[model samples]
Target chain A: MRTFEHVNAPDVQTAVALLGEASTEAIAGGTDLLGELKARLRSPQRLVNLKTLAGLQEISYSPKAGLRLGALVTLAEIERHPIIQERFPILAQAAASAATPQLRNMGTIGGNLCQKPRCWYYRNKLFECWLKGGDKCFAEDGENKYHAILGADRCHAVHPSDLAPALIALDATLRVVGPDLDGELSLEELYTKPTESRRQMTILGPGELITDIRVPIPKNGSRGVYLKTMERQSWSFALVSVAAQMNFAGERIADARVVLGGVAAIPWRARDSERILIGQRFSEGLAERAVEAAVAGAQPLRDNEYKVSLAKALVKRVIIDLCSTTD
Target chain B: MATKAVRAKKLKVAIRGPGKTAIKLTVNGETHELLIEPRRTLLNALRKDLGLTGTKKACDEGTCGTCTVLLEGKPIYACMALAIECDGKSVETIESLSKDGQLHPIQRAFIAEDALQCGFCTPGQIMSVKALLDENPNPTLDDVKRVLSGNLCRCGAYPKLFQAALRAADLVRTGR
Candidate 1:
């Protein structure tokens, strides 16, 4: 890792002010940022440590106000919280399926949401992909198995967070704090594609920090499920994952939110699939149709065509599993 | 909103600028003070500065759990953690498990079941298991598998390791 100054911020405002300095980055859990620094992907002059900041480690919940998760809450806490496991099973399942026990204990939820892509090509310092200000994306033509199938224009690297898809499916909102930008935005707004001027995954401005995440209370008759498939049994990134939340009126679906991960630059919200499921009676055949609509416009690369089918299958499985459960 | 008010209080911030800083860490119930660069990892500090070589460092990255240690009683990869960030924090390594030269129950179980082949990953695997068994005395088979997933055993002693973990749980529960 490159040599740099380290400062423990007293609070959020000081943290934001320190990050506004030249070539400075925020360090929360240091699981992803430290790895990036060691790999020479990023060489910041200073690191503003956010672990010392108070009031960002609490996890509170209420039936009226829903769930409020401080940015510094570790993934292990989420996986073990009784309220999350019972009320928001999808989020708990996503947290449990991520990385491993040791990493989960070290990785915070806010850091997990802002994690960089896991593409081998992007991670390697030899090849600077378009996202890294290079000419072309090496994954576009070589070793593109783990690349994205959706929202892949300038970059084909897929988003690696398992929690982001589940949180988006739950309609979570993030409280962001910065020098001039301090407000709440839906979780979906946190992600963006690589545009002409912006070659990043998220639209977070420099010096901005995610303070906390707010998840809305599930409807009276709603339930959610998360399903992920990996190359091995454990400790591997998701090959394809689906998070499905459905509101049912008796035996018919009233509302649905379906999101796919490991198949897009962002957590790909399956609006078409959601549209197909609402107001329809839950059945195996309907799930198949919804899965078809979910993968309608996927443009898979040469080595990732199997992801489309895998994502579709996971979508179907999650929807079916959610419908089969009673509450 | 509440954080804004707290920010206005002008809290004394600990800023370690452009130079080495003195950091105090509590390792294995002993306090140690060291002056080091901010870029130094806790794993290196433990091995070099504190002379605690029981904790192995296989993959410097967070992937391999060979550097597993307990930070505030939660298992975390030491290689991924900065020594400066560990100021005033308690860290328990593999060296702290045994007391008065008597092997810990988990250590005894590992020896009895022959869970280790080459023993390169034994320290890390033992630390992870110790953390799990510390929290959950009666861990299920799935719990053992999930907790040790990060610790890679190239010797492929997973079945024997699993048996040892179960045996350790039984021994601890019965006070054997």
Candidate 2:
């Protein structure tokens, strides 16, 4: 690991001031940042520690505001929270399926959402691909097995978060705090198109920090589910995952949101499939149609042709499972 | 000579890697205060700084759990944790399990079951199993497999190790 200054900040104001001074990075729980630093992927001048900051490890809910998840709240806490388990079981299920029990105990929600890609080329510091601001994207032709099938232009890397798909499916909003102002923004707006900036992720600026994630409670008769298919059962990233949440009136779907993970540069929201599902009765044929619409026009690389089929199969499976689930 | 005296002038300098930070950690009911570099991992601090060498280091990249230790009664890969970050926490290694030359029940069970061939990964496996049993004493076979999946043994003693864990749980339940 490289030599860097470590400053523990007791409050967000002081942490923001420290970040404003130089090339400083915030460290919450240090589960992801420390691993990146050790791999020589990041070399910051200073590390601003946020563990000492009070009131940031909260997982509280309000009748008016719904669920408020603090940045410092660990994945284990979210999985174990009673309100989250009752109201948003999909979010809890997603949290429970990530990494191992030990990693979940140490990894915070903010770190999981803001983590860098797990691509072997991007993580290996020696390879300067397009995502790393270089000209060539190595995954375009070379070893493109895990590359994106959707939203692939300059870069084809896949989004690795299991939580983002669930959060976006629930129509969540993020509360961002920056040097200028603080406000709420939808999770869909947090992601940017791959063509816009190949190097940057969310629309968050340099000095902005994610303070909390607020998920609105669904109306009555709403059901949600998150399902992930990975090569290994534990301690591995997902190959394909689907998050489905729908509001049902009798046997027909009223409103629905479907987000696919591990298949695109961002949380790939299945807008066409969602539109098809609305005002339609839940059945095997309906799910098959939604899956076909969701995966249409997919552009798969040489080695990742199976992802298109795998993604379609997962979407159909998850939708059928959700339809079978009772409130 | 005057030249010799001038050449002997003291030059106070500090040459350290990333500067040394004082961290106080408790292990096995003993508190140790030591100066460690910022980049020093908990595995290095345990074996090199504090001389508690029970925790083994294998696949330092966090894949293998040979460096597993209990931090606040939860098993974590020591190689992935920085020593400086655990300044005010409690750590438990395999060395702290026995009392007064008496083997812990888990150790006795492992011996009785002949759970070791080379014994290289024993400490970490024991620590992981201990942490799991502490939390869930009567864990099912599936639970045991899930919790101990992180730790690996090259000797392929997983079956015997599983028996040892089950025996240890029985001992804990029966007060044998």
Candidate 3:
């Protein structure tokens, strides 16, 4: 409940300029930032509101320009958009399955992508985990049944978004804007590990803002699916999730993008699984092999040994279900 | 020395606007003006600021639906919403459902079915049921379950809740 200055930015440029000149932070829907500020995880001298900016709320599609999802597009809009559901069912499924109806109505796609991690220790502010610039990770030795099982060195927290792994599988690109600067980068290049830098998880520079996310029109004969396993049927993060996209030619997998969530420091992509399915037909056996390959190099901590097995099982289920999908 | 210097050089910026922001909102049907800080959540501003304590604040991080309220006729988590953001919108809390001390149809149905145990989650459940009935006057048992999944009753009153919602739907359809 601390006092902080608030300013409403009417445009991206003005918002960026405001951020550059003062100790400011952006507030899109305030679903995440306000909570974080209240928890004292972040202390900004000023809050730059992004809700008034026009044209940042549209969800547009083109055969040429692909799908352009603006920064302020709510999760409900993404979930219910006909074109998104038809063309990119993976994204739609991930969006529709997030949090709950009320959260989906208020949470913006940009905020969901840019929101901080949901690690219990990190949010509590009392544990001082390694991801929070502290020397130790409490989840490393504590109750880590939800921690990562892949791609962990010094930190083992899993990526919290169910949409992020699906977006990675769709080969989406991100467009970021800041003061006098604008650029686009693939979604793969957007995330980095805590081992790489303890300070930030994304490649966005300090004043940079995510403006839009674009997904190229995938070629014909492409099919994708997102499957998640949670302890509860609703209102909980995934215990393990998989986003599988299979490009097939006469039942043989021509191309595949297999990304694993709830099991890594980043959205872990299983390149080995992709390599194994290059010419092989996707069956229950092949799916099992892919799952084995997906969790091949996992080094589970003391309390998170079950994540590796759970991740393998979810990946196998997703691939099996995806193979059953028709063009 | 360093802390004192930092505090001395800091500008006196009013975090909220000059004085508390006066937000004029129409709750249910009545208009009211309330002074709230920029950081106060809509749930707090409604309950603490205006003394409308019908909207509960359980699991304030948007997980539980105890604080569910209608913003311009759409259900949203009141805790995650800012007070200033509701300036010109119509907010409907649980207290607004009763007309001249008569319980709303959903509230009456809930009581008739004994759908509440401790009654902590009753208001949110009733508000959500109101929204569901507003959209779909005749909802199936599955539809009622889908809409009420976000509202959790620790006492396990879901069977009664489902029955009450079904009964409310029937009443709304039959005009009884």
B99: Cα error in model 2, Å: 1.8
- Superior by TM-score: candidate 1 or candidate 3: 1
Which is the leading candidate under lDDT? 1
Pairs with steric clashes in candidate 1: none
Q: lDDT per residue, candidate 3, A1-327, as tens digits?
A: 466656667677767766665456888888888778878887776677787789999999998988999989998899989999999999999997788878888888888887787878888867777877888878887877888888777776777888889998999999888766799988888888876364556767666888999998877888898988888887778888888887888888888998888887678899999998878887777777887899998888787788888888887877777777785
Model 3 whole-model lDDT (C-alpha atoms): 0.82
| lDDT (Cα, tens digit) per residue for candidate 2, span B1-176 | 23322322221111123578788999888899989876788889999998888899877777778888999988888887778778889999999989899998999999999998999899988887898889888988787777777787889998999988888888877877
Model 3, range B42-109, lDDT digits (tens) per residue? 99988898889989988888877999998877788899888877777899999888879887788889
Ranking by TM-score: 1, 3, 2
User: Could you give the fnat of all candidates in order?
Assistant: 0.80, 0.16, 0.47
- Please list the C-alpha lDDT of all candidates, in the order they appear: 0.91, 0.82, 0.82
Q: Candidate 3: which pairs clash?
A: A4-B15, A5-B15
Pick by DockQ: 1 or 2, better one: 1
lDDT of 1 by residue, A1-327 (tens): 988878888889888877776688899999999999999999887788998889999999999999999999999999999999999999999999999999999899999999999999889999878889987988888999988988789899999999999999999999999889899999999999877698888999888999999999999888898899999888989998998888999889989999999998899999999998999998878988999999998899889999988987788888888888884
Name the runs in model 1 displaced over 4 angstroms.
B1-12
Runs off by more than 4 Å, candidate 2: A194-198, B1-17, B114-118, B154-156
Tell me the TM-score of each prediction against the true structure. Answer: 0.96, 0.92, 0.93
Candidate number achieving the greatest TM-score relative to the actual structure: 1
